[model samples]
Target: MSALPRLSTIFLAAITTLVAVLLYSPLFVPIVSSFFTISHGNVDWSSPTLSTYVTLAENHDILAALRTTLIVGVCTVILSVVSGTLLALYYHGRRSGRSILQFIIFLPFLMPPIISGLALLIFFREIGLERSLLTVVIGHTVFVLAIVYRTVLMRLQSMSRTLVEASYDLGATGWQTFWRIILPNLSSAMVGGAILAFALSFDETMITILVTGTQSTLPVRLWAMMRLGFSPDINALVALILMFTVLLCVLAARFLIPRQVATERT
Candidate 1:
């Protein structure tokens, strides 16, 4: 709060702003080009059009890839949520090996994507699994499992043990306690995890590229198209995706923010 400290804080804020601008500069180029004409590696400032959006609608291949990405995202969310919640429940307490196994569960996420993808690719080939959407789903699930598991586990850890005890003292069976008491508390965390998982799966490119077959996700498709130069439609698609991602983040925060915060504010 002192003057010198305040100046230091201002300098730090300025540095952070510059870093953010540097990071977003590349994204601005595509978005800017989407609205205007580009000629000879430069944007034609006088011309502005929505032709790219029209082109995007007509591009069936990209649309198909987009569909594939959505499908994979949904599948990944479902699988990761189920498995992660189960793992959290199973390993919540009473085990010496659980920590080691949890580390193993998280290894794929901690390791580089190329390494994880290569390992999975080889594992699949050895197990006779084909290169396809199914493989992509599995890869995505593995990659996202750590996030889902961590989120659910944190919620579980934060929940008061007395709640479970009180439920049982009221003559609730184990199943009843889990279904009525535990699941309700976990619902928000599960939803938040699902959103995070879906977002990661939606944009996952490295593992998808390695494990995918003929059906490509949007990111992989975009990567291939970039080699041939992107049209205006790609920028339109990027803009739409950015908007959607922001919306998803807002929804996720809504779900994940603790109810106690709302109570306090009110």
Candidate 2:
């Protein structure tokens, strides 16, 4: 490569590293502080301990909120993966009306969260549905449906149809073909979609704040505590949540990278 191109690459790399540090500074601070003592709004680097995690464990309210977050995440994952997969499979081919319907399905995710949340809130109230964890799950599923749908749909599109034809030529029933051939091929996409849905639900705040009732998810609970300033345990919670989210991403990558990428590349 020319010197100019090499220099440009180095400059771009430096800028990217700087941006990454700036973006992750908040996350880094909390994680580092989680292992240390905090006093008078400053982290004490002298004493490193797991006391904050212990405090986090003893915090009933935070624990309940975390439980609620997990519950919402799991429900949202299940609903999103199933609905998204079905939609992807059903609409894999183009039809005039299907494009409009797919657009509507993605509207919640395409719009701002505030708008989506307000719309859902009003719709729920108009239908005599109360704000609760179920509402939160619905809101999260709606918000994340676009991501899941797109992921599964792309996988479906990239899939070769020869397998299906061969299955039928072998005298397999529709259900058998779907169960044995299609489902296995789409499994990784479903897993990836589920992970993305759960991650979104785990960290969701604005929609959860609007549509949730008395019981709040972890993000909402953390938002509520902002006025009082968070304790050291909040740092512990952040560190843990960050770790868990990273783990989910790793698993998703593992599932989707092998056969899924091959399908797309082909």
Instruction: Give residue 28's error in model 2 in angstroms.
Output: 0.5
Q: Which regions of candidate 1 are displaced past 4 Å?
A: 1-4, 260-266
Q: Per-residue CA lDDT of candidate 2, range 36-144, in tens?
A: 9988877788889999999989989999998999999999999999999888888875566887878988999889999999999999999999999999999999999
Q: In model 1, which residue pairs have backbone atoms overlapping below 3 Å?
A: none
Each candidate's TM vs. the true structure? 0.93, 0.93
Candidate 2: stretches off by over 4 Å: 1-4, 259-266
Give each model's whole-structure lDDT.
Answer: 0.90, 0.89
Expressed as tens digits, the lDDT of each residue in 35-111 for candidate 1 is 87667778788978988888888899989999999999999999999999999888896477887879988999999
As a TM-score, model 1 comes out at 0.93
In terms of lDDT, model 2 sits at 0.89
* Local error of candidate 2 at residue 119 (angstroms): 0.7
Candidate 2 TM-score, C-alpha based: 0.93
